[model samples]
Target: MSGLFVPMTKANGLGNMPDLLEQWAGSRSVARAYGRAGLPMEVIQFPETWIPVDAIRSLFEISARAAGDRCFGLHVGKDMTHKTFGLWMKYSVQAATLRDGLIRANQSSRFQQTGGKVVFVPGAQVSFWRYVAPPMQTSSQVQHCDHLIWPTIRFIQSYLGPLWLPEWVDVSYPRDADARLLEAQVPFPVRFGTPYLSMAIRNRDLSPRTPRPFGDGQRITFDAVRASEAAGPSNETLGTVFNTITLRLLEGQTDIDGAACQLGIGVQKLQRDLRREGVDYRDLLNRAKRVRAQELLSDTDMTVIDIALSLGYSDHGNFSRAFRKMTGVAPSGFRARKDQMQ
Candidate 1:
């Protein structure tokens, strides 16, 4: 199965722009490393990484090849292990049950190349990290870095919302600070430090599932295991469902019929599919609206009515009622508490 990543050239402004990827031509070098490993690539699509996880092992293989060489452009490391086993890496880290497993994979990231280190920020009370590497030297990899970092914060919030999600995240590189701000939109408090790039997470989040060994017996045996892991969770289209609903809602729904028309699917089908996932379309909509509301409240001074209108409620009263039902507090009260926290 093919994996979907937000290509820097056209992520459609999901969170952050593809602006940073231009700076890290890491994709080109990784492609060359792949070539050295004996794979012919008409094109390779990274240094624009997705959420760090086992699927990223190929990148580590490349980094190890490039640690240091007579020339910056020369390959220092290469891994053909995945190739030899006939395995193509395309996995999602969000499916992992615990944040700890995610962090382990990220820290042990040589998923594709052994080029950089991801470290924990001391005393940050979150899943903070410092990632650094020399720039890659290729134009095909333009804007790839945005995929790795932008998707990360979005993924944390996606995989685990504010309840289990960190209250805030801070990045620790001065140069990346502005880009990080745009990437994160500074969801909480993101900062840049002198020698590191980091984002703080909640303290409790760092200790989820203990990371399992990334499967290494004979390369053949490990290949089978890796394939199993990359396999879809039985076609549980969570991201697809979410994106579909949001896209429909964003298309200016005037009613359930209009929304159904926009989705190009029967209302019954939508209802049935959502029921199979143990949620109704309304439930999903409210959940999506709740997240947008929280982010808007924390980041903007929009009136509750404006926020309500923006979220597609018929009017302020309905928005208020729905907001109160989704959250325990009234819209104004929620905004006030959010304001106080600031």
Candidate 2:
């Protein structure tokens, strides 16, 4: 298999699109749409997983057609919260100012998708935050682009107020039926057929501003998120395989077939690819399970049973034995040691 087979993206990049689709259409329609898009329903079941960007584009088209709404992406974006992107959004929001936050987001954009770039360009009077989509042709670019642009506007609104608007927004795709729909949603002008997708913000609005507060005590620190991202998958076949396994493990799924499906490949081909990298699927699964177990024990307050279930362990004794075998300590004892160190 070629390394450049298809571009992959974190499922979280789809944000609340699935839920919004369910609300507008129905659960059955959502299933049909996933089927038509050549994506397993498990992708939605585990938003932490990675899937092909093409599949996402297909989903956008099917969803829009089913709902008879050209601006479905905009609606999903408007309904999104900070939780849409999870730790990435948390890390950005923790910055000292909105400008700092945008810089941080640009730096950590890889956490959401691959083969795309988020550039933060500064100007004397105005600044531009641009999203460069991957070089792929699709009829659904408008929907996909709109999905990304509006949440960004909302992020700016976090620093500015709810009534705040951008000077103007740019869409890479040409004008379509949704152009008027897009215009109606934003108070500012919308430009189409531009070089790339971007929005203009005044330098004054990008200045120092207070971050929103999170009352949840379980909020992960910005440093922790950064460290996790730094330790993420590399640009290798083994790294991609390992990342897919880790994400599937979070949803209590450890089957090789599921991982292969998420990667848009076959089970035998996946095994062959891993062998070429000189690693076995079982070894990677065990490694991912151990890493996830340690993270859950140290970073969350969930009980041993819940953690075990999340890792796909059907029996508590089995999980305890595996945990001890991997880390040389029981889950409870591990958590205790982590707490003491803290």
Candidate 3:
């Protein structure tokens, strides 16, 4: 499979209005909610076009502000079922096993509004499928984290039957609000203020368990979704390239030729392919570095110098210059602003 896919934007919220509005508990008008969130009414009404991940988070913010319920995301997650994600959900649901379903969901996360990827990490006792996303500590981000994790929970229960549950659920962010609403819904213990976000599964349960056979029509729909996504944009390939560069950077491997070799292409071929898609390797590297740096600065209390070294900068001074050039603010200043806002 291609490297872990990260979409250019978080998953779109096209088909989630019914659930979100329902979660609002009729406290506010749809028009008022959209206006409050600064989202277009037509977008929520039509929902044919993809909404940004940020916008989905904004919707939760507005709902929380207007409804005074932090559990809004958990409520909205109830609608993120087969119908919400369309064919992608169908593929996941009809897979041979729960593991297969999670794999299918992981591959199509870009289309599913997952905003990030679900990675299965193996352990000696209990392995887990972890939800990975770009780091930013905001109420909206916390809600977005819920949007990514809770659906996976619901999907597992649906795929393995209602009796199924993950061994446990772990989230990176702290519990800033009452989690009783979520605890009541989940069968397993729900944990907060963890190092990462993950749903641990028993190692033995990772095997394929034939649920139900896929109907011919379901197969057709799955194939069509795959084809549509393949033809939609080159973001998947670009994401793969960016992931490679970032991983290599962490390993102190920063040469285009090395990345080309790892990708099994000649340097010239890699350059030509990226150029065809209007991508510059250096610019892409810079963009990835900027994003990684921002995530570290905002999500962790790591020193600026430490973050710079982690990003492969020779020194903090060079990292700061590049950061200011790209973001128009020093790293310290950015962190201070983010801290105040959060």
Candidate 4:
């Protein structure tokens, strides 16, 4: 199991998911889904515990199939409330403004899940709230992606009112007949075959608003849970190192020293650790760059040179050489191939 774990609170949605699954698919199917994921149904009772992300993905995929609904993930996300994520939701709801809440959520997301990140990019006109999935490949990310996006939209609506809509939604998957089901539910345009999953929020809607009060009982419980969890062993692992590297790359920082510093470790120690894990730091760095480069090439209209610079390459030639060496295709050629496939 990779060290990547999503808190069980976020996974089972505070016991709401199993009940919903049972309603959508039936008790037998819910059991089968859990069994296939190698997780017992009772695991949802442990909200403070964490489970491997792979298991969560498997559960979503299995449940979607069992429910016989292509939009099952969206439905599941739609049904979730703030209670689904416990403290994570509390942090957001208690903020002074929607923007502040989103920023806090972005910062606190590491406590909710590992291996991926939610980035809140603020802008004067249109800000973007993006979900960057783990760099590792998965069998099917459709349900997982759908599951993530809807909750974020719901969070946004918590402040903007239930009827508020984003400027647009970008999904990485291709448009299919089933996509219409998603499109039908939202007034905003839902674009498919994009590089990432994101929602565009207008700045005007992000004004300061009254903060929601956190009651005494809830605050005491939240603090107790936080203290207890803080006493537990650190969950940091190589998977987290990869996640950190990916985030640093997105910020246009490429040096191993920077990544090591961010991880609170010396460069030599980091190298030694990777060596023990049967991995090389340079290889991992290259892998992250390759994955990000491919995403920019295939999804956005950014020029190859711009992508290269953004990924920290000094010039177009070096980036092309590195990209070709890893992928056997130049950046432009790769983008062309992707376009043809679409």
RMSD of each: 18.8, 4.5, 17.0, 19.9
TM-score of each: 0.36, 0.77, 0.58, 0.62
How many Å off is the CA of 267 in candidate 2? 6.9
User: Alpha carbon lDDT of residue 258, candidate 1?
Assistant: 48
Residue-wise C-alpha lDDT for candidate 4, range 1-342, written one tens digit per residue: 443322222344423567778998788988898889755564564444455566677788888899888887777777776556767667666666888877877876666666667788888799998877655334776776777666778788777777888899998678887888888766789889866789999998887595555435244333543553452234455555665565566557788898787565888988887777777778778877887788779767989999999889999999999999999999999999999999
Residue ranges of candidate 3 with Cα displaced over 4 Å: 1-29, 113-115, 137-139, 147-150, 214-217, 220-223, 235-342
Choose 1 or 4, whichever is better by lDDT: 4
| Candidate 1 local lDDT, 1-342, one digit each (tens) | 222211111111112111221234455664555345322231121122222222122333343335431111111111111122122221223224445434543533433323355565546554554554323333211122323444444334434453343454443334432343343333354443434344556667655542432235223333453443341222333333443344333333434454454344677876676677676666666666776666567667878888888788879999888878878888889878877987
Query: Clash number for model 2?
Result: 0
How far does residue 277 in candidate 1 sit from its true spot (Å)? 2.1
TM-score for model 1?
0.36
Q: How many backbone clashes does candidate 4 have?
A: 0
Each candidate's lDDT (Cα)? Answer: 0.42, 0.79, 0.65, 0.72
Q: Which ten residues in a row have the lowest lDDT in candidate 3?
A: 3-12
Off-target runs (Cα >4 Å) in candidate 2 are 1-6, 42-45, 137-139, 208-222, 229-232, 246-278, 291-323, 329-342
For model 2, residues 1-342, the per-residue Cα lDDT tens digits are 356244667787788788888999999889998889766676665576666677787788889889889888878777776558768777776666779878878877777777777889999898998988777745557777778776888777777777888899999889976588889987789899976889899998877667555436355565676676664446457667877777667567899999888776899998888787777899889888988888788877889999999898987899999999988999999999999999
Ranking by lDDT: 2, 4, 3, 1
Candidate 1's C-alpha runs over 4 A off are: 1-235, 247-269
- Cα-based RMSD of candidate 1: 18.8
Give the number of the best model, judged by TM-score: 2
